[model samples]
Target: MKRIVFFGDSLTAGYGLHKPEEQSFPALIQRELDAAGLDYRAVNAGVSGDTSASGLSRLSYWLSGPVDVFVLALGANDLIRGLAPSGTQRNLQAIIDQVKARFPLVKFLLLGMQLPLWVPGQRAAEFRQLYRDLAAENEMPLLPFLLDGVAGIKHLNMHDGVHPLAEGYQIIARRVWPVLQPLL
Candidate 1:
């Protein structure tokens, strides 16, 4: 069986949600795999409010031994906290490099994040390009925006509007499954 590690912040962790096992995006992906008769494990490495640096810090824990494919979803918290975009990109790239140093054959899928258009367009564009540039450099499948169709939708997000609701995760699962299906 193949294994895919999902590394991300609050979104991956399904923060503020009433249930994780039922509503977490990773779990939803697992269901997809099951229905497709794919023998795969979707390991949820999500940490609530984790920054890129934080994800890098937990590197050894997730990348140890062997990891078939990595679902790298991070940088949102870093952006929220106004951390340097270069730092986020560097940390993420370093993680992939380190994993390759050990596993050599591991594949990757990076989940990109974005800020609202109301924010400074220049800074936002730079942030958006970070994912694009990194994915291009690493040749990883990049999900342009993890919150692509769900963000800013009143019914799709929770009351806090920072996290997705059940329906939102379903949408996320649907969007990601296309790229993830063959891998599993």
Candidate 2:
């Protein structure tokens, strides 16, 4: 079967959800795939609190099998921890490079993340630009902001206001579906 890997941090991992396998965006995508009778499996390679660097390091293991599509959703933790955008960009590029090297035919869908409005201007701008630059440079489709509709919506987020609740994931799944469907 063809495989689509959802590689990222907490948001992709369905953090704070009671039933991750059923509620996570990746799982939700899988459900859509199944409903459409698509012969594909959506693999959730999300690790809560993981950074771009860590994702890069663990990429090789996930590369063991054939990957038809790679949905990169990392870098949020890097931004949250105040890491330099340059470093995050570099790490993300390296990860992409490694994946391409392993699976030359693998398609990519980059999921971008944005900092809260409370963050400093330069940092937030830099963070946002990194994903845009990467997608442009790689000629890949990018979801401008992964949390576009869910962020800052009090009822949709967890108490920490960082992660989304189950309902929020439902919205995210809908947003991601159109982009992912064409890929499949």
Candidate 3:
């Protein structure tokens, strides 16, 4: 089966879930692929508290295997830690570049993230635009925000008010399927 790597932070890792292996968005997508008769294996490569730089540093391990599609969902930690958008974008771009160099035919689906408007300064706006710019430069399909309907919804997220619950992941899987399915 072909491999689809879901690379990101705690959200991709399904942090705090009782069964992340089975309930994470990547896992949910795996089930969807199976139900749809798609011959693809979803690989969750998310690391909690990981920044884009960390991801870039550890990318070689994920690249060891054959990759058919790359789903990038990083940068949340960067935003939380108040990192520079330029650095985040550069690190993310490097990850994509390395993956492309290894697997030229691999498709990419970028999962975007946004900061709350309450966050002071222009950083919030810049953070939001970086994803769009990256998608445009890479010519990849972009999911405006990974937590679209789930974010800020009391019932959807866990107590942390950051990560989502299983139901929330299900919503994410649903939102991702349309864009992801077309690529497959």
Candidate 4:
């Protein structure tokens, strides 16, 4: 089966307390692919609290062989922790390069995140721009604001207000399915 790797942090990992299949976006995407009769698999390579740096470290292990698609959804914790944006960009670029090198025909879909626009600096803009830059450079599919209508909404997020609830996952599935369909 063709494999689709969803590589990222807590949201992708479904960290907000629930069944893996129901909460994780990858599982939802899997169900969608199944219903649509797409011969593909969604592998959740998400590790809660992981940064783009951590994603880089595990790249070789998870990408040891040919992969049909890679959904890069990392860098959130790095942003929350106030890490340098340049480092995040470099790590992601490296991972994309490595994946393309090993699996030349592998398709990529870059998932971007957002932060409070009033966070008191240029951080949100810089972080958001990273996806645009990488997508342009690598010619990959780009999904702006992965959380979209779900983030910060009381009912959709967990008590911590960072992760998504089950309903939020549904919203995410609805949003991502169209973009993911063509890549599969």
| TM-score of each model, in listed order | 0.95, 0.97, 0.97, 0.95
lDDT of 3 by residue, 1-109 (tens): 8999999999999999999999999999999999999999999999999999999999999999999999999999998998999999999999999999999999999
Instruction: Return the lDDT, model 3, position 169.
Output: 97
Query: Quick one: ranking by lDDT, best first?
Result: 3, 2, 1, 4
Which residue segments of model 3 deviate by more than 4 Å?
117-120
For model 3, what is the alpha-carbon lDDT of residue 37?
A: 96
Which regions of candidate 2 fall more than 4 Å away from where they truly are?
Answer: 116-119
* Residue 171 lDDT, candidate 1, scale 0-100: 95
**How does model 1 fare in lDDT?**
0.88
Q: Give the clash count for each candidate.
A: 0, 0, 0, 0
Tens digits of per-residue lDDT for model 4 on 31-78? 998998888989998999899998899888888755899999998898
Q: What local distance difference test score does each model get? A: 0.88, 0.94, 0.95, 0.87
- Scored by lDDT, the top model is 3
lDDT of 1 by residue, 33-151 (tens): 88988888888899998999999999898866468888999999999998888898999998889888877888889899988767876678789889999999998888889998999
RMSD of 2: 1.0
Model 3 lDDT-worst window of ten: 115-124
Lowest summed-lDDT stretch of 10 residues in model 4? 114-123
Off by over 4 Å in 4: none
